[model samples]
Target: MLPDISVVLTTYNQGKFIKKAIDSILSQSFNNFELIIVDDGSIDDTKRKIDQYSDSRIKKVFKQNEGPSSASNVGISLAKGAWIALMSGDDISLPDRLQVQYEFANSFNYKICFGLPIIIDDEDNIIPDEDFPVFFSDHSFSNRKVFKRLFEKGNYFCAPTAFFQKDIIEEKNPFLISSLQLQDFACWLSLSKKYDMPIINKRLIKYRRHANNISSKNNNGRMEFEMKMIYKNILNNMTWELLHEIFPNQFSVASMNDKRCFEIEKSFLLLKQSIKSVHEVGCEKIWNYINDDVMCSILSTKYNFNYLDFFMETGKFNTNERDESND
Candidate 1:
């Protein structure tokens, strides 16, 4: 029988946690789903453990070490369900996770659904005193509040807990395999732009934060790289006029910060292009941005102007900052 959903999980050397992760899906209240496990060149007993599972609903894909994004893409390409639910090899979904999300999708005609998640330690124990929600509720991710929050504070939803319509990914061509890093953020940002991101408040998955996990090991580096691309790809695409139209108050500050950051980069580039270009018409464009009361006020408080000073002193923009550069 064709499954109602395709649960795509990418596994590497997660031999220790793979069984528990797979078992969680099998034990789900909603059983009409295919558990698609893509083993991305696991050198450990990860594949051996998967071989032990005899369920007809389980589909396994093997590939060389191409990273999670490529594995997900392969799984997505082979998926045969109406919805594609994403999970990590180390994460565990609650028994009712799919039932709840599936019901939400069917009831509201939602194309994408995500929920809160409990942070787990290496031992698979939930964080101390973390109150996981008992029931699911509505949360609109596309609303200005949610959008602004996501953009300002960074990613909000639990990625492994997300369930998106298959057609959406097929149409958007989600998950760039080349990123090797922050592929989730890149895909999510693309999806967010095209669809109304809806989130459920219930904690439906246990997000494992282990030393061996890709994210845990490269958190800072990956975040910096992702932020740089987000600024260039997402923020740079927005016009100042459009920003004011979409974001009114709280997001206005974020938009101003984005604009200033862009202007600063542009000015630094122009300064490097030629000393004479500093007097060009485009050079004055930077002043126009700085002249904005809100941007100037914010910069007055930010002491890290090394980005601006680099070009002024050395006549070239330094890719490295006192802090790591995002891209």
Candidate 2:
């Protein structure tokens, strides 16, 4: 018989913490779960510790050094449950974590749900909430409202605290292999477009914070580039009405049906957010020209877009000297 939930716990080189993480899952109040452990090339005693677990429900997959997101993907692929729960190998989940989520999902028809994370230190002591950013766990998820919040407030849904219906993964993989730092944020953001992401606001997970933690720290400039690309992809697929719903003041009825105008407006949103690398206002057209190869082909092939005209229309193009030939 298939379990009701599959908890995917992913790790790499966190052998010291993995034992506690595994024990936490094994001791969960809910018994209808299969635990999947994806050890991503941990060069430590991670495997040795996992071997100590003789639980029949525990499934282990050891693969080469493929980063966290890739490891998560492997676990998600092997999940054999109606609902999927995400757990970090370094974090400790409370006893009722799965039961609370399962009951809530069974009652409410929500496709995705997240709980609050109580931050913890290396020795398993609780850290005060004032030290880290607060979790906006109670916000009700509406498609337009949540997308708007994600665009402005960024991700608030705690990653490993998430318990979602497995079917959504069929539509899209929740984890993106390339977005190491923003994988959870990107998944929530992407899923928000299709489902109402709710909050439990109750059950707690000990979100471990340490020097080696991958949850919060920035992984170089890759995050910035990934975010811009996320926005661009959303713009490419989202309806104009949905776009206006997210950014109400940025669109007019006349611009609603105009594809060219819509493209230009999306570029404006990206520019206002400083999503481009140059961090300059007037370079949206130039950024689109250089960054998006597909959009470049479409603009020239379909819109007959004039770069000079488009650049001048924004009115912020700076010039060394404003003369007819130079401008």
Which numbered prediction scores highest in lDDT against the true structure?
2
Candidate 1: where are CA atoms >4 Å away? 129-140, 170-173, 211-218, 235-244, 248-327
Q: In candidate 2, which residue ranges exceed 4 Å CA deviation?
A: 212-220, 274-282, 285-327
Candidate 2 lDDT over residue span 174-229, tens digit each: 67787766777777777787788777778569998885543322443465556645
Give the least accurate 10-residue stretch of model 2, judged by summed lDDT.
318-327
Residue 296 of model 2 has an lDDT of 65
Q: How many backbone clashes does candidate 1 have?
A: 1
**Tens digits of per-residue lDDT for model 1 on 1-327?**
788999999999999999999999999999889999999999999999999999999998878998888898889989999998999999999999999999988898878888887778879776642332221223655644444444444455667988988988744347866576567766766666557778876779988876554334365555555555444445446555544544453234444657565455444333333223222323444455456776555445552443264335443334343222111
Q: Residue 44 in model 2: shift from native, Å?
A: 0.3
TM-scores across all candidates?
0.71, 0.83
Screening candidate 1 with a backbone cut-off below 3 angstroms (N, C-alpha, C), the clashing residue pairs are 224-326
